[model samples]
Target: MVASSILSPAIADSLYAQSPFHSDQHDARTGKFWMTSHPTEPGDNGVVPLMKHWGGEVASMWVRDTELLAPLREIGRPRIIEIAVPLATTPDSYSAAKAVVATFGRSIGAIPGKGAFDLYTNQALPPSAVLAIHTEGDPTFVAMGRTYPTGFVDVDAGRWKELTGEDD
Candidate 1:
C-alpha cells in the first residue's frame, strides 16, 4: 500500500528545528554527521513508528527503534522507519547524509546515488513503509524497498565486507 501522508521540505525543517536531536560527525566519515536523539531519559518511542505509519520508509541498518532513543548507551533496536528527503540530483553521498541530519533528522543511511537518505524525521514526502523513493518529483513515487547502507559502513569497510561477503 502507498503512504497516506507526507511532509513538505519547509514543514520538515521546521519540525527538526523544534526537536532536541543533535548531529555529530560519523565515525566512518569525517565530514558526515549522524544526527541522533538524546537518550538521557525515556521520553517517547512512538514518534518514529508513527512517522512510518504516516509514510516513512524503513531505511537504515543502524536505525532500530530499541536503540534509537539511547544510541550512545545502546545499539540494536527494532528497525525504525525513516523519511527520505531529497537534497540534490548530483550531490555526493556525504552531502546528502549531512542534509538529512541538518534538515530532516539523523540519517539512517544515504540513498544510493540519489541525493537522499532515510531521515528519522522532518521528511517532506511520506514514502511507503515498504518502498523506496522511485522518482524525484512532487509527491515522489515509491517502489519496493531497496536497502542502501552507504557512508555509515565505509568506516569499517573491512568488517562490513567480511560480514556481507563483499570483495575489495
Candidate 2:
C-alpha cells in the first residue's frame, strides 16, 4: 500500500486478480502459483519465497523503486515500461498514515528503490492489514492512504488503464 515505483496499480491488479488461492501447483509447493500474462502456462518461476510469506493473505505491493520491476518482469506479470504517472504523497501525510498502521502492526522499508517512505507490512502483521477497503474494485486496504479521503496518490485509474490496458 505504501507508494512504490517498482509496483504499479495495474500490475498489482493483474497479480491479485490472477492468483488462484488454492494449491495450483503439484510440487508440494503449497501456496505456490505462477504470474503470467498467459494464465494457461505454468508460471515462469515459483513465487515460493513471496508466497510462503504472503500466501493466503491480501498483500500490498510496496516497492522502493524500479529495482523490484526486474523480479516482476522475470515473473512475467504485467510490466509497464513507461508509467505515464506514478503516485505520491507529502511526507507529513505518509507519516500520519504510518502512525495509524503502526498502532496495529510493524512497518518496514523498501530497498533497491528510492525514498524511505516505502513502508510495507512484514513481521507481526495484524489481521487488519489484510482488510479490504473498496475504492474502485481494486481490492484495496485502509492502512495505506488512497487519494480519496487522504489526498495521497491513488494510482489514477485512467492512467493505470493506459499503462496496463486494464480498466478499473
Candidate 3:
C-alpha cells in the first residue's frame, strides 16, 4: 500500500501480522445499540461497526474484480506489501497511501478498524497523482499514471492541481 512515510518491508510484515484492518466507532444514540451509560462493567462489547476477514477478501476481490491488480504471487492466499511514497500534500492523495486498500476497497469484506486504508488522512488516495513506488513480498503494482480507483482522493484534487500548476 502507499504510505505517507517510507516504510521498511520488515515493518509492514509485522503490522500485517498484528492486525491489518483499522477500526472506529459510530454513534447510534437513538438506535438499539448505544453506549448510553458509562460503566456497568469493564469488558463490555458495545454497538460497534464490524469488519470480517480483513486481508483475505482484500486479496480475493483484487483477483476477482480488477484487471488493474493481481496477487504478487501465484502461491500466497494472503499477503501484505508496503510501498514507499512521497508526501501526499493533499488529503485525497491518501488513497495513494496504501496499495492494498487502493486495489480492493470494495470487494474486500467490511473494512478493518475504520477499515482498509483507514490509516491515512482524508485526501490520501491512489491514482492519477505522481508517486514513487517501493515494494516487498510478492511485488504488487499500482498504476500511478493511469485511471484512479473509484475512491481515490477527490478531497485534495483541486488543491493538488493548484499546487502542481494545473487548472483549478
Stretches of candidate 1 exceeding 4 Å from the true structure:
1-77, 88-94, 97-123, 129-155, 159-168
Better of 1 and 2 by TM-score: 1
Estimate, for each residue in 1-168, the C-alpha lDDT of model 2 and write its tens digit.
Answer: 226444667756655654443334323333322221111111123322342222223331333335433445343222111111111312234544544454333225321111123222213334443333232223222212333224443222255565568985
Residues 1-168, candidate 1, lDDT per residue (tens digit)?
113224445434444443333333233333332232211111134334422332222222234443232321222222332333344422345755554454332245433222333223223343453333222221222211222322232222254455567876
TM-score of each: 0.20, 0.18, 0.17
Candidate 3 stretches greater than 4 Å from native = 1-24, 27-52, 55-76, 88-119, 128-168
Residue 121 C-alpha lDDT in model 1: 26
Best by lDDT: 2
Residue-by-residue lDDT tens digits, candidate 3, 1-168: 426333345544544443323212113111221111111111113211111112332222223323222222322232222322334432334444454453354346423221223222224345543333322222232321112233334332354454567776
Better candidate number, 1 or 2, judged by lDDT: 2
Q: Candidate 3 at 122: error in angstroms?
A: 2.2
Clashes of each: 1, 2, 26
TM-score (C-alpha, index-matched) for candidate 3: 0.17
For model 2, name the residue pairs that clash: 64-113, 65-113
Ranking by lDDT: 2, 1, 3
lDDT of each: 0.32, 0.32, 0.30
